[model samples]
Target: MPDSRDRKARKRDLTPEQREKRQARRREKRHASPEVRFILDNNTRVPVDLRPYSLNWDAARIGDPSYYVIGLAKGGSTLMHELVRSLCEAAGRTYIDVPAALFDQGVEPARAVLDPDWLRSRDGSVFGGFRWLHPWMDNLALHERRKIVMVRDPRDILTSLYFSHAYSHVAPETGRLADTFDEQRTQARAQSIDDYVAGPVSLRVFRNYCHLLALTRMPDFRSYRYEDVIFEKRQWIRDLAADLDIRCPEDRLDAIADAHDRQPEAEDASNHVRQVAPGDHVRKLKPETIDLLNRRFAPVLAEFGYGTAS
Candidate 1:
């Protein structure tokens, strides 16, 4: 059989423009709703006062989340997702895959494929994020209610991402696995040394984390931490349940064990797993490299309790 990567190449690798086309179709579908149409075209011209009409009856009537879990990759976001999934299952509450649309096709898929009425308030609905999640959360008129939002300390997130990137895209399956934290730097140096020594993983992680942090600035959001999830699963779930105004089940929250046994290892599924090991990158990254990452990602690193670089 063909390798899994090869399968993904055909099934998932869509170009940016192709994704835009998909989103256009999804938006067209959303626009077809009478409520959406009223809000868009005639909201300004309405004779009655606008504030009451802006209310979200759906969120008021049936409680199902359409919120985003915005956080850096490998920042325990995936495990948090599993925990939330488990909570919903335990309570027998429907997990609605937010019918909201997506634009980009990479971390986020286009909204075009989602039906305007395609809400799955049943159990175990898998919702795509990094696209649909952002927009859905931002639209105040279209309330997602609330869901879990988590962030790990940047040091831990940096470590996990570094190693994961190395194995997933750079390292080989054969004899030698080069954790070249000095990726592309050793060769391109003498001219653009700073550029060469710069870590790609650090750059991506910092930027995405900063973006995720910005979401809490929006109203109706609840923030969390990796430490809280790891150390206080029950409290974490309770807090999340309160924000979402949903009942969290006792059986759903599980203790943090060597969860890798129950799930895939970071390196094995780092690129694609729903959950990844936090801070595994520390082993692969050298001390100097960590310092370099600290400097490069100081903004987000500081925000996540890593403190300012001296």
Candidate 2:
């Protein structure tokens, strides 16, 4: 019983015919080309310059029980990874290597979460974007509600770092143990947990840790020590797993130790390794060099309990 003017007003709104036509148009657009589809999907971006970088991760791929290893340079993370894998293997659970997984981890969520935006903001302003990456990098967000933590030791860390960088003789992959190992790391290969002492890698790793601290306000952020891992393996691992609300079998840790014994003799083959071994650094380090390391890495070492002992 509406008048002509009212009916005209109603007609101006979306009507049955209008709705049908609009829906038809949307249906057509759904089948459109990739380029057009992208334009439609990414309309929220402001007029920012499109750099070679981006933070376009999906943050939803990794499973709930997943973990991230935020190890600093010279930390015993490589051994940690091997140990974790051995444990996970014994439990019949899978532990993906974070260091190497960033490069094409053969999974859909890995793809989405490793996008442009997240890639860009990993560390300093220089490496922000899809172009930059950390070896063995794993997005905490991708873990689909899993746990992420860092483990390290204080004295051994400084000792290993000193040898890792300015060794008048230490040369890893990049050069003779100089600035970085990244130049030689394969873009196709995932991160390596064993490359703990490869230059200033921890400098970058710490930046990532800072980012995580800012993003997640959770109280249970984790940091473990290599000593505890070596001495109180079961208690610590079990505690870590419990913090993450899961059951970690101690037998897996034992298996990891056994597996570690089976690896290359490279660990025991070199003097550099020997110098950095537990108790050796304290005995061998020149007083000045020890002071220098303690000074430069004081903050990190303190967090890991270095100052009180050596």
Estimate the overall C-alpha local distance difference test score of candidate 2.
0.40
- 1-310, model 2: which lDDT tens digit per residue? 8899997787679778897887656544432211110111223221211221111212212222334444444555555555554444444443333223222222211123323333222211111112122322343343333334444544455445444443322333331222323333331124322233233544544554454444245544555665555555556556644544445556765544554543334444234343323544566455554565466556555555656344
Please report, in order, the local distance difference test score of every candidate based on alpha carbons. Answer: 0.45, 0.40
TM-score for each prediction?
A: 0.51, 0.48
**Candidate 1 lDDT tens digits, 205-308:** 55666656666555676667776556556566666555544564444343322232244544453354524444543544556666776777777666656554
What's the CA error at residue 309 for candidate 1, in Å? 7.2
RMSD of each: 16.1, 12.4
lDDT of 1 at 283: 49
Q: Best candidate, TM-score-wise? A: 1
